[model samples]
Target: MTARETEWISIPMTVDVPYRFAAGRYLTKTLTQLRDNGRIFAVECPRCRRIQLPPRIVCAQCHVRNGRWVELPLEGTLVAFTIMFLPLTDPTTGKPHEPPFVYGSVRLDGCDSVLDHLIHAEPDRGKVWVGMRCRVVLRPPGERVGDLSDIVHFEPLPDQSRPGS
Candidate 1:
């Protein structure tokens, strides 16, 4: 074998590299609240008036420490989307999910940022589009987990018409 090929295989896939992460001050308490109850928590930066999802301890825009917690709306509008061809079993239900699942970025109402979530739309190429309205559907009563997946997936809203012509 050439030196290059020999060197490539010599590297170990497993390593003792230290995993370093910025330890937050209050993430544990914040996560506990969410896991115990079905609530979406975010931090509001007093400086920029921007809310950070996942409840960041610091504001990314102004680098200021956020002091207030805000509960955001679960409903949102689909801003972008893509179809995934990968098929796999869902972790919660040990059952296989259908392929061609739609993943989308939804801009939550009353927030400046968008949250990515799974969409439950059919895989027909002609059906999905940007700016489509979608809303969160919570999991069954006994299956709540307080994670984003607690909401099964976003589905297109039904077309409601006016009362009279």
Candidate 2:
């Protein structure tokens, strides 16, 4: 086929699907704890000793069944982050998060996996950064549902300075 003879076609369509999710054994336990007791739980791999959030049945690292349930401290380090300028839909709530917000990945104390969520900080570069210490903020016990949305957001701890600033 010659380059000038090519035909381009475009189609536009929208599909809407709604469904409920079954959290199953491991995740249900984790979400339930957060909702009921305001606690975070992770599973530890017997072989590799890797601690994972949203507790999984098997360890990704060692391929062994994860059994030990460890309670993680709410405090963690903000290992990565970004100041978002666009309004993005929050999948958990099916709502649009307002623009000029902050989002980041937090590595909770003692857990290997990082949980990504909104950061309750000013949308300014000077206000947020990697290595910033943060703590999980959850809704009041009665208001919390058994889901990741139980966490309102991660708030940066006070009295800290960015490295080499």
TM-score for each model: 0.70, 0.90
lDDT of 2 by residue, 34-91 (tens): 9999999999999998899989999877888999999999999999999999989876
Clashing pairs in 1: none
Q: Which candidate is the best by lDDT?
A: 2
- Per-residue lDDT over 98-130 for candidate 1, one digit per residue giving the tens place of the 0 to 100 score: 778898998767667788878988776567778
The C-alpha local distance difference test score for the whole of candidate 2 amounts to 0.93
Against the reference, the lDDT scores of all candidates come to 0.73, 0.93
Please give the distance, in angstroms, between residue 155's alpha carbon in candidate 1 and its true position after superposition.
1.6
**Model 2 residue 35 CA deviation in Å:** 0.4
lDDT of 2 at 70: 97
**How much is the lDDT of residue 15 in candidate 2?**
80
Show pairs that collide, candidate 2: none
**lDDT score at residue 151, model 2, on the 0-100 scale:** 95
